[model samples]
Target: MELSLSQCSKLTWTLNVHFIVLDCPGTASEQAGKSESCQGCPNQQLCASGATKAPDPAIAEIGAKLSSVKHKILVLSGKGGVGKSTFSAHLAHALASDNTKEVALLDVDICGPSIPRIMGLEGEQVRHAQKRSKPFYVDDNLAVMSIGFLLSSPDDAVIWRGPKKNGMIKQFLRDVDWGELDYLIMDTPPGTSDEHLSVVQYLSSTHVDGAVIITTPQEVSLQDVRKEIRFCQKVKLPIIGVVENMSGFVCPKCKNTSQIFPPTSGGAEKMCADLGLPLLGRVPLDPRIARSCDEGRSFLCEVPDSPAAKAYQTIVQSIQDYCSNRATEVQRAT
Candidate 1:
């Protein structure tokens, strides 16, 4: 019997198969049934038949469409309110600041699409001409695409299921004409869900630079981040690094620094050390950052001399360095 998603979840539960199955040879892999980890799995036979391994035609189509994009970076967070979208917006802005580089921002957080508002393109709608959709431009170099642009009202809700969400993501990847881009930053919804899997699967044929995981200093946030790391590992996606947002707060008047979230367990630095990951940089809580985001302005430009801005620049530079090194390695290999 073909099991539904719910059924598969229940079976995983019954078999005590943790969602973070570290050794799981993905169902689409050739070792699906042959691997020791698949021995007692309920869907072992079905996966072994190679039925689920059939590559989606859209994957190739997407790869072709995004061939001109030099680097594809996914901004992910295990929980919301970690400034993942903010980081994505700034990353695009920073890259486009070069003027010579073209940058694109794609928001895949369908249900809770905030990129439109965050990027100050809330009232903007995607223009369709000759059956092709064009992303909205923030400037000459920065372009953005999000489901938020499709809705008639910013107050509208996108009540969609897994299949619908997946289809929409496919359209975004395949239909949108990004032209040539130096970087394509995708801001995804929190957690390891259908959207995450869909994007990863669709971009499988493309050379994805990697993912930048965002998190706060709190242990609660770190716990979910660990699961997210495992999800990336299981999917075989490279992790660029981890960013600790709202790391601390510096009082303007007193020049005193305070641990706002309080990294109960040594925060992202300790976590990164433990996991062998890089701690990109810690962004301090700045009221101006929030104000700038709310007003649809670039915080880096708004407060160029602030420590938070410096931290962002440092982190963005680190990401650029990583992408440059990756490109060099690819070129050498080729």
Candidate 2:
């Protein structure tokens, strides 16, 4: 909850049962008794009632560091094994393909950092800086950062609690040397939990471009994807669009497409219409796409003419258009 305070005074708030006192810009005595400074404060009741507290201090640093980037897009899936990470890797590669633009792919899935292996940077290590850490360079236009890089071995497991995971996420946002970039595509773990809340809170100051949700054509996946959509709505994050992956299977030799996971009653297109969201595109499943991923090669780059690759390009174009339109609106508002 947000309350606009018109006056400056000492405010006492509790966080996790611990009391924290903050000195506002006005008189100190206003916190105790009625004063001129507290007359028009919108948050007077909140402060007096001690209902809410200030956000974490690291948020400011996160915002400051992320301000250099033009856009931040989160790639998330409600259910696991939905090809979310693969989509993020391809999206980043496609965006960075333009030599004029810079892009950073941040793998925020602490427990499962698949981006490094998917992007073909498995054994890379993170370089340290005085105040931040350097991202591993993929090329002149592309860079990547992930906890997988910090591990001594690929088989090492990340055993952490909610607070520990949150702290690491804060560190990633506040201390990463992203430099100036056109986009930062974050691949989040499946589900809305501590990591998602932490990332959203840290980036509150930065205007996050939006989120791209991924789902398959099955009802089971769509059910979870529905919850993911509601999570975005509850958090007020704009849904740029949705992509239906593995919607169908394409034959390599026959050049024919078949619905492997055909919708029983409805699919992404119908669901999007019901939710008032745009169905970005449908990506048919192809064996070459999986083969490319396993080989740590971008299917989009390796087989640009494939049906799945073409679908990805179409979705990327839609996202670019959305961002361009949002930028124009911001310029007009300013």
Candidate 3:
């Protein structure tokens, strides 16, 4: 059983080729071929040649395209059905309410883009011009873009792989004419997937204000949120704060409050405390909120006096403060 080092290496590679392929250092990675896992991979030689290491010129192009955008914010969630898109829509609406600020909302959830429906632009299509494609404008100041608009029908499925999804996101950033936005809010899909990676990479040269993570009160949502937080940290993206959605439900008849999704393990507040993160105000579960979204209307305008609306106003104020403070610091540094 005493084998030479070369024999041992060959045996290891042979035994782990499948696993190594699954987790290969990408061809663009500097460690692509040098890593031990690349011993028997098919792309080893090509990767080792350093051909794929060339930087994509699109990153710079996207940065320049979005230079007119002042604050870029990504709204993310750990899991689906957590109202990530709803928050994104409302955030854009609230920001544009001032009429002085121009806001753009870009939905990069390629697989299940709900922004079009939620934003009342369901059947809208992107208009191509001489150079840049124009996004559908919700109003004079608010513009919206989503893969939903490209689909012939809302029911059509986008069964694209990672590469295609990444390409679409790149086009959204580089091709769309956002045109001097005060804020560009990207409504990202759940989890740290290809879409998330593409947006972060494409905006690397740009100054991203931060991300607003949305979560429910239950422990299940909190668990996934921890992973999201780690992803943001690894990517060096700033965390503006965490918003606890559906924290509780209030009775319209009696004005009593009840925990709809009970925070079994102390919810986002406890989680934020443990992680030293800011706990953005919690939004109560309001049936009217769902109705407004279904009807493609703004809940803030519909129920401005409701507790949920008030909570949103507070959270949005916090975000505005954060962005203003960040801009001040950047100015000082410059």
Q: RMSD in angstroms, all models?
A: 5.1, 9.7, 4.3
Q: In candidate 3, how many Å is residue 112 off?
A: 0.4
By lDDT, rank the candidates, best first.
1, 3, 2
By summed lDDT, the worst window of 10 consecutive residues in model 3 runs over 124-133
lDDT of 3 by residue, 1-334 (tens): 7987456755776656665735667667879788778877767888899986886899999989999999999998878889999999999999999999999999999999999989998887654434337788889999998988888787899999998999999999998888888999999999888998889999998999999999999998999989889889978999999999998998989989999899999999999999999998899999999999988899999999988999999999999999999999999999
- In model 1, how many backbone clashes occur? 0
- In the predicted model 2, the residue pairs found to clash are 8-26
lDDT of 1: 0.90
Pairs that collide, model 1: none
Root mean square deviation (Cα) for candidate 3: 4.3
Q: List ranges where model 3 is wrong by over 4 Å.
A: 1-28, 37-49, 127-132
TM-score per model over all chains: 0.88, 0.83, 0.90
**In model 2, how large is the Cα lDDT of residue 29?**
29
lDDT of each: 0.90, 0.83, 0.90
lDDT of 1 by residue, 1-334 (tens): 7987566755755344553265568767888767767767777898789887888899999999999999999999888889999999999999899999999999999999878887899788755544337888889999998998888787889999888999999999999899999999999999998999999999998999999999999999999999999889978999999999998998999999999899999999999999999999999999999998988889998889999999999999999999999999999999
- lDDT for model 3: 0.90
**All candidates in order of TM-score, best leading:** 3, 1, 2
